[model samples]
Target chain A: MRSRTEKTLIYALLIAGTVTFLFPLWWMVAVSLKTPEAAQAATVRGGIASLVPTDPQWHNYPDALMQMGSVRWTGFLDALANSVVVTILATAGTALSSSLVGMAFARMRFRGSRPMFLVMLGTMMLPAQVTMIPLFILFRNLGWIDTFLPLVVPAFFGNAFFIFMYRQFIAQIPEALLEAARLDGQGWFGIWWRVILPLTRPVTAITAVFTFIFTWNDFLAPLIYLQSDDQATLSVALNSFRNQYGGITKVNLLMAASLTTMVPCILLFLAAQKQFIEGLGKGAVKG
Target chain B: MATIELNCVSKTYTGDVRAVREATLAFRDGEFIVLVGPSGCGKSTLLRMIAGLEAISGGTVAIGGRVVNELPPKDRDVAMVFQNYALYPHMTVEKNMAFGLLRRRKHGGISGLLFHRAERRAELAAIDRKVLDTARTLGIEPLLARLPRALSGGQRQRVALGRALVREPQVFLFDEPLSNLDARLRIEMRAEIRELHRRTKASMVYVTHDQEEAMTLADRMVVMKFGVVQQFGTPGECYARPANRFVAGFVGTPVMNFIEGRVDGGAFVAADMRVTLPAARWPRMPAGPATLGVRPDQLRVLYRADAGASSTAADGASVAATVRSIERLGDRMDVAVMIGGTRMTARIENDDRLVEGGSVLVHIGLGAAHLFASGEDGARLGDAHDAG
Candidate 1:
């Protein structure tokens, strides 16, 4: 009797929490389908009406894509393409280089290897802002300023955190496997390619997903490096969209654009959700 | 097949931690040598050094009369079967066996790329044939398409063995390859490995802590302790004439028993009784405290009409002991007897109806007895054969 009441109360609290967390996403979607005036009016309703607009403004998506006048070339499509190219290249570079560097650190036995790994780990502790100025100067001297090189080239060098994560994952692989490969006449590079890479698919997926999300959502680097409207990524273009149209009338288009920008990340997470969770769990335990 | 020779090989980890001490040994062509010892005895380390899987800190390891201390494991012309089998989980059994062959060729950069695809395909087909042939030989042809995780422990072990065998290397190194299998499977695999060795005639070094396995499989056995080689000899020689107390205790099933006593007036004097030394041993026997080592089978147990009669015998050759326990092992029984303050086991025929707490006359086979100097390092003074 009393347990029944307690269960009811617990379920009620859970439902309330779920609604509270999901309300923003629900409102964003609903408002994206509303006209500017209706969205502004729905926000005043403060309840169900705000979460579900009465008459959906389906033209807001097409309008946001075409009417974002500050964008160059084919407007939002060009920005999306730019974002895709940069994110894919940068993510690929990060995944490949991080895994190779990680395998070397975890398996190779060279003098100063330990200290060098420690230094690499120490770089993770240092904030990206600390190296931001120096990196800018270096890129500028290389004549790579106002180009995608500044955003994508650094990824090829490897990320300290991802390398550390990959190293931990690779370290958990039995040393016997490496020894077996060596006895099978595989050099270090061959072992890394043929043996280690195939076995680390889950970890590579985790790295790729995280790198894709990071590069896709990153606004600061794109803001600094991408100067022309033509080279601007979706993130930079979206930020510029907010700045250029900071009026109440353009709110619906902004919400629609934001929703469009987040769909790929959301879809990717959902697609690789199983591997992502498994990789995270494995990393937490082994690392 | 090749003769592998290790000359004063040693392994010292960072901070001067010695895993394998300066040890010298050699494996002749087509010989099955087993390195048997307890864990941390450096047997595995020694085998790895020979395989070129480990860096030799000091001396040289020569394979096929060529020094390979600086060579990588791939270049050493040797294959190793690890304790855990170490099968590539991502690969099927056929691919696992063919992997070594595929990587054996060294292709140069640009010029290699031109003809690489055609050559690689031909080589791969040849490797596949070799893999299938080896699989057929091991009776694992059906399992060739299966991944390692899908196979049973024994099947995986067979695949691991197949992988090593497919290489046809100069030497084969097995580091406790059967340690993971069940008792029955281990026994079956033992015979399989021995038969394989006979057929291939490849020089092999097998490592295991199981003395029984070592005794049955080895043409010659190395008994080690504390990273040192205590004895290296044939099984019969090691069991009959051990180099030290350690070797004697390590090589046998029911361990050799050691009783502390003093050598006085051509007799071994203990607190409870005295043992008369054989006439031949007395000439060389030094007058000092010593340990009398005897195997369970070497001690003779005699039924006594009166329990106290042997205890008070004038000659004092036999000791009176009370039967503490009996482990009946089919045709034989291990009878634990309490002789004075010391407890020793005696292996006798199960025909006798011996009960606990019953007194008996225990005679030490002096002709087969082993004597060692009584100290921390119990160096062997003489063996039973010394009597002659």
Candidate 2:
């Protein structure tokens, strides 16, 4: 009974700590909606701040949306579209390619397969900053600058960390399924496609969610490759809005755009929560 | 059906751990052969080699008159049932059974033609019918709509069997398929598999460490140890006359007892006891101590008072033993007797009237006794040598 109470207390303390850590993000959203007057008033009042505006200025949203360009809402729409395309393509590419390659690394037999897998694993420790200049040069040569291709095409091959994660997930599958497939006239490719691919759904869903969120929220990659304002993702576009609007920024519109950017990922999580939790459990148990 | 011939087949790992030594055996078409051994004895490895799941490191594996060492498992035309019953968890039983045929049809049955939906669907439907029929045969029809996770272990095992039977392959390989079941389920499944084999008339190669399963199911048994074939013959041949000490010690329940003694004037003598042997049909005596083997059922227990005083003459064949304990197993009783400071068990039919620490007379069946040469190599020294 004492240990149970202790456990409950530990869980409560952990939830308190998590809320504490999340306060900054909550404060950012809360403060973004307030006018300068309201924000200062809330700060002066100290505990229990209000997110709503007493004198609501709904025009601040359109003003913030148009601040980066002559047109009012086109900039937000274009940036949103660019972010969606890059995220979808990158997530799909990473999930498909990395999973296939990871299955091979986990189960298949061939000369130098181990060494190749090791090399991929070795890349995980490498600092991306070291390769940024070379990647930029290569993209320039390929005429991929100012395009989303530079940001998404590399995912088709796979990231080392994702490949490692996929390989770990695939390794937990029993070898009996593969053998059973073989007896059923299934060749190597057949076993992979029919047996392994179907069994890895949880891991695939988890990988897709993480990939989508990561690519959607990334700022550095877009800032480097996307040279044109029209090609800018939401992050870069948000920066451009802040630059144009100056000190009296339309905080309400910025919060609306941020909230808009976050909604898809949140919806994805809600839709796949069961599989995502199962994937996390599977991964934990495997290691 | 196919005849599998393993010629000098061996498998050695990189660290010189020999999983299978130069083991040679042959399986006749439609025969049920069992590879029985202790744990880590490489019985499963030999079966995998026949199924082309394991590579033959030394010799050739010929199946149906073709050398299959170069062939992959898919092309080997043999099916295997694993101990774990590796059903695809995501697939329903029906879909799992049809997956193989659908794949084969998609690949033009390995000719690599363009995928045709019509032909694939027809093949899958045919396979589904066969799977459903086999599931019914295995008494698992109710589980066809369920995923593997929803089925019990026994039901999952039947699904695995159904999947294998749907292929109608030439050879069936079983790798300790009943080891995972409870005692009752194991017995039930064993009987079902035996019946299935009799009906299908397919050549089967079963691997297991359970002696009872091997004895009951195998037409011929191959006893293995340390990756070497210790003995190979009919179960009766193995039980009645073992090739060596290992086979004799390994194949029986409660095991045959071995006692050290020396032959003296056609009678084996140990300490204060001596028993006459069937000396006329045996090998020339080796000039050293020898070991005597007697099965528990072959040893008879008699109380000292039960044997009349007149029978205690100078025959030298009777021994005085102290009864250590009596185990009444409902239909039979196993009495443990301490003879010359060594415990020997005698299995009797409902002889529960014996008491512990009481003196008794143990009579050895002279004709049923087995003698082995007492050397570093314990070879059976009897007429069975000629049989071997």
Candidate 3:
């Protein structure tokens, strides 16, 4: 009986916490449906009235899309397309390159492998901002500025954090399995492709989802490298939209555009939530 | 079908960790040889060297008369079943068994590409047939479609065995394959493995720490310690005539007992006990300190009064002892007896209801005694046939 009451109390607390966390999201959607005048007027009422608009203006979506006029290619749709392409390619490159490097580090024995892996992990500790200016100069010298190359090409080399995650997951596989595969006539690459890859689906999903989200939301690199409107990603394009229309009358359009930019990330998290939590929890615990 | 020869093979890790010393061994064609030892004794390391999973540091390993030290595992044409039954977790039993054949190439380059589709299909069908036949032999036909995680320990072990058998390689190496099974299942699988060896007549090398498994399954047993082969012979020969004191103690259940003593005037003497040695039987007997080894089953325990009369009348040696403990094992009783501050176990028929602290006499079977030199190595002194 005591346990039952405790369970009820815990569930009640969890529900209240969920409401507290989700209230802002609910308010964002509600305000996006309100006209600019109504949104401004509702803010005076405070609390619940401030959250829910008196009249829902569904036309605000198209109006917001149009008000942010298309540059040569900086229109909302084109920017969304650029984000999707960059994210998909970068995510694929990161997963493939990171898992391969991680497998070599985890399973192979070589003269300098231990020191090399340690150096690779050390890179994760250095702040990305430390390398920002040098990287910009290097890409500029390579004639890769104002192109997607600066944003996507580096992922093919590998990411230290994702490589570390893959190494942790791959190292847990039984050595006997590798030996068995060897006896069954598999070479190193064959074992990696067939045996190691299939078993590491959870870690791969986690890496891919994380890379997608990171690349999709990354504004700083795109802002620095992409000078033309045609190459601007969603994050940079959205910021440009805000700068162009900073008046009080355009607040509803801003809210609508912000909500549009966040939908893909939210859907991705929902789709792969279980794998994400499992991969992160297991990697830390095992390491 | 193949003879495996290891010519002074050795394995040394970095930091000078010698896992296997210069070990020379030869396994005959179609023979079942078991490498039995305690943990860290290099039995598994030796097997891996033969399977090409481990590098041979000092010597050459030849399978079917070809030196395999430089060859990769696939080119070596050997299969190994690991202790954990390392089945591919993602594949079904059928695919697991057929994996090796699918990966192998029958022809190379342009010729291979010309007939690739037809040859590949034929190879797949042949692999399926071989896998099905092996699964049938192991009685796992119904489980061919299921993954390894769904199977029980015994079933998984059978599938692992089938995986090795499906390849039909020249040599089969098993590294403690049944160590993970329950007691009853271990015994059951032991018989199946021996039967499989008999049917296949393939040269097999098995490694285990279980002496019973070694004794029952091996045509010849290699007893090792500290990366060195102490003795290699038939199980009966090793049991009857161990090369050193280590083998004598390692290869038996209810281990052999040792008593330190000195030889004086053609008689062995300890603290308060003496046994007259027959001069005619042991002609080269040196007069010095020695160790006497006796199996538990060779010592007969009798009641105090009967022991007193038998000692005076008997032609064998007998010692007065007090029973320290009595363990009734259904058909047999193992009685721990103390003789002159030394403890020794005597296996007797359970018909006698002996109790703890009871007075008894332990008769040493004169012909069953083993004499070892009283030194650090404790080398055997007489021919094993003399023990009879």
Candidate 4:
């Protein structure tokens, strides 16, 4: 009876924490479905009417989507396209390049390899803030001031943290597998492509998902680099929903646009959640 | 089939730690040579060096009269089966077995690959046929579509073999492939491997730490210890006429009994025990300190000294000892006895009179004993058959 009561209390606390965490998402959906007056009223001092929509405005989605694009700037549609391109390319670049570099550091034996790996890991200690201005200067010199190359191209060079993760993950795979591949007529690159890369599916999924979410939701980089409104990502364009006075013009429209921006990240996390958890412990024992 | 000749090969890591010292060996064509030793004995390292998976630190390895010191593993035309059955985990059995052939195939060049696609298609079909044939030979054809994770241990072992067989490389290197299986499966796979060796007619270099596995599989085995080859001979020769005390003790079951004592005049004596050597076994003895080794089968543990005279070895060499333990094996038993504070075991028939704490007479079969020079790593002095 004591254990049962403890389990019930534990479950009750978990449910409370879960509801607290999910409240904003529920509010976002509620505001997106509310009428314009109701959404505007929600912006005012704590109004209970904003909690639930009395009369749901289903047309608010299309009305808000139409407000995204205008003559002065390419609006929401263009921002969505820009985010898609950047996210997909950056995720691909991060996954492939990071795993390749990781495989080299993990499996190959060269002179000073240990020190090289240490130096690579040491790069992770440097904050992105330290390199942001230098990178901006470099990208400006490369004629990349308003282009997506500033955001997408750096991913191809590999992330230090992701490479460190891949290196550690690849290191635990049996040495005999690589040796067997070598004896079976596989060159170093061939062995990595054929054997090492194949066993890293779970890790690859986790890396790809994280890269997708980071590239999609990134606001500061896009705001800094994307000069034209046409090339702006969804994260930066989400700011356009408000008027010049910093008060939302259509509170429901802003909620709708913001909710749309978060959908891909949520779906991606849902899709990769299984692989993310499996990747933590699966590589240690599986073939 | 290829003949492998290793001339004084040695491996030394940094800080002057030697893993394999100057080792000279020669394997005949189509011979199954097994390198057997305890763990950390450098047997697997030697096998890897032969397969070109490891760089040779010193000397040269010549396969079929061609030196492979500078060649990479792919260029050396050798295949290895690892201990863990290192199958490409994501690939099906068919793709795993065909991987080597796929990598080694050439399509003339980039332009030929585009212009002559028919040739590449034919090559792919031929590789598929080869994979199927090898899988059928190993009786894993039905599992061609299944991933390695779906197979049983024995089936995975067969797939590992099939992967090597499909390549048809010049030489086969196996690094303790059956070490992971259970006892009964190990025995079953041992026979199957011997059968596979016979059918393939390929020269195989097998490495194992298990002495029994090495003895049963090897045409001629290389016994190693402490990075050095202790002895390299046929299993019969290693068992019957061991080159030194270590080789004698390592290659037998229940272990060979060693009595560290001195041979004074004609008999072996240590502490309070002395066994009179027969004149025929040791006539002209010139020995100081020596270690005597006797096979368990050669010694007889008699219940009574008077009754032992008629049944035991001729020349009547017997010592009084208390029975420490008797392990029964139905028809035969392992009787461990304490002879004057020294413990020795003798394999004899399960006699009814033997009991723990009871004293018995242990007859020393000097005619079949091995006399070695004193101290560890000692040279064998002489055998009973040849010394007299």
Best by DockQ: 4
Best by TM-score: 4
Docking class of 3: acceptable
Compared with the true structure, what per-residue lDDT tens digits does model 2 show for residues B1-388? 9998999999987798899999888889999999999999999999998988888899999999899999988888888899998788888988877666565565355344345656655766677788788878888888789988888888888888887887788899999998999999999999999999999999999999999899999999999998999899999989878877788888887788778888777667787566655545564564568888888888778766854221222222557788998888899888888887778888988764678988888876655667777753377886634655
* Candidate 3: tens digits of C-alpha lDDT, residues B1-388: 7999999999998898998999998889999999999999999999999999988889999999999999999889999998988899989999898888778758433566686868766776788899999999999999999999899999999999999999999999999999999999999999999999999999999999999999999999999999999889999988988887888888887888888898778777787577777665556677899888889998888775654432422335788888999888999988999988999988889846577987778887756677778864587777536567
The sequence of per-residue lDDT tens digits that candidate 4 reaches over residues A1-287 is 56988999999999999999988888888899988877877867546556787788888887777787564234877998999999999999998889999999988888998898889889999988998999899999999989999999989989888898888899999888888888777777878777877788788888899899899999999988889989889888888887789977888988888887888998988988898889876758466
- All candidates' TM-scores? 0.91, 0.89, 0.91, 0.92
- Give the C-alpha miss distance for residue B313 in model 3, angstroms: 8.8
**Candidate 2: which stretches are off by over 4 Å?**
A1-50, A57-74, A108-119, A244-249, A283-287, B106-115, B283-286, B306-316, B375-377, B384-388
Report per-prediction Cα RMSD to one decimal: 3.3, 3.9, 3.3, 3.0
Instruction: Show the lowest summed lDDT stretch of 10 residues, model 3 chain B.
Output: B307-316
Interface RMSD of each: 3.4, 3.4, 3.5, 1.1
Sort by TM-score, best first. Answer: 4, 1, 3, 2
Alpha carbon deviation, residue A116, candidate 4 (Å): 3.9
Task: List ranges where model 1 is wrong by over 4 Å.
Answer: A1-11, A36-50, A68-73, A109-118, A240-249, A283-287, B106-116, B280-283, B310-317, B382-388
The recovered share of true contacts, given per candidate in order, is: 0.80, 0.76, 0.71, 0.80
**Model 3: what TM-score?**
0.91
- Model 1 pairs whose backbones collide: none
The better-scoring model by DockQ among 2 and 3 is 2
Write the number of the candidate with greater lDDT, choosing between 3 and 4.
4
